[model samples]
Target: EAAVTQSPRNKVAVTGGKVTLSCNQTNNHNNMYWYRQDTGHGLRLIHYSYGAGSTEKGDIPDGYKASRPSQENFSLILELATPSQTSVYFCASGDLGGPNQDTQYFGPGTRLLVL
Candidate 1:
């Protein structure tokens, strides 16, 4: 099974403050993704990476940044956090091929509150 973990299960940040959310995957998947879950919007993609040293913008990448330092680590960076950016963030890992292709394994989630 693919295992994914996120840091600082819960967080509180001030407006304009810098916040970083980290994720790690035990399975050596080729793709990693960062998403935010909001009440009515569902899970919206913030950023993703095909592999290490590469990052790509997703659906809602306006105020976030992503880093994939290795096959097992991915980080989400918020240079200037705002209340509007507060939400539950999730990280996922998956591969491109096999029977379970495109199937993502998600982390527990990180709740952020920007005041």
Candidate 2:
């Protein structure tokens, strides 16, 4: 089974503060992604990595960045956070997927609030 877990399920931060969201997967998947979900916008990808030691920007990578130091872990970094960045973030993973990539499994979610 594909399992993804995210840390600090909820967070509160101040403007200009730094926040880090962590994700860990036991599926040992080759592909992992970080996305933010907001009203009307659906889930938009922030970053993704194919495997360890690699990372790539996604549609909404402006205020966020990602790191994949190993096959089982990925982290999202928010630098100088802003209220605009406040939203529910999700982490997902897939194993050698193609057309069925839609089967990616998501973590519960991380609600981030910037005060």
Candidate 3:
């Protein structure tokens, strides 16, 4: 079974401060992604990594950074937190889409509130 875990299930950050969200997956999937979910915008991909030691910018990479140290670990770094950045963050891992990619399994998610 694919398992994704995130640290600090909840977070409260001050504006201009830094918030780092960490994720780990034991699925051994090739592609891992970070996404944020809000009321209107829904889920937006922030960053993704194809494999260890490699990262890629996703749909919205501004104000956010990602690191993949190994196939089992991925981290999302928020350099400067803002109220607008408050949302639920999720980490997912799956095979690179085609016919092989089943479905991206997501973590429980981290709810971040920036004040």
Error of 3 at 31 (Å): 0.9
The TM-score measured for candidate 3 stands at: 0.93
Per lDDT, what order, best first?
Answer: 1, 3, 2
Off by over 4 Å in 2: 97-102
lDDT of 2 by residue, 1-115 (tens): 4378999899999999999999999976898999999999999999999999999999989988899999999999998999999999999998676666647878888999999
By how many angstroms RMSD does model 2 differ from the true structure?
1.9
TM-score of 1: 0.97
Count clashing residue pairs in model 3: 0
Model 3 lDDT at residue 47:
97
Which candidate would rank higher by TM-score, 1 or 2? 1
Deviation (Å) of 64 in candidate 1: 0.4
Q: Can you write out model 1's per-residue Cα lDDT over 1-115, one digit (the tens) per residue?
A: 5399999899999999999999999988999999999999999999999999999999999999999999999999999999999899999999999998999999999999999
User: lDDT, candidate 2, residue 22?
Assistant: 97
Q: By TM-score, who's the top model here?
A: 1
Question: RMSD in angstroms, all models?
Answer: 1.1, 1.9, 1.8
| Total colliding residue pairs, candidate 2 | 0
Candidate scoring better on TM-score of 1 and 3: 1
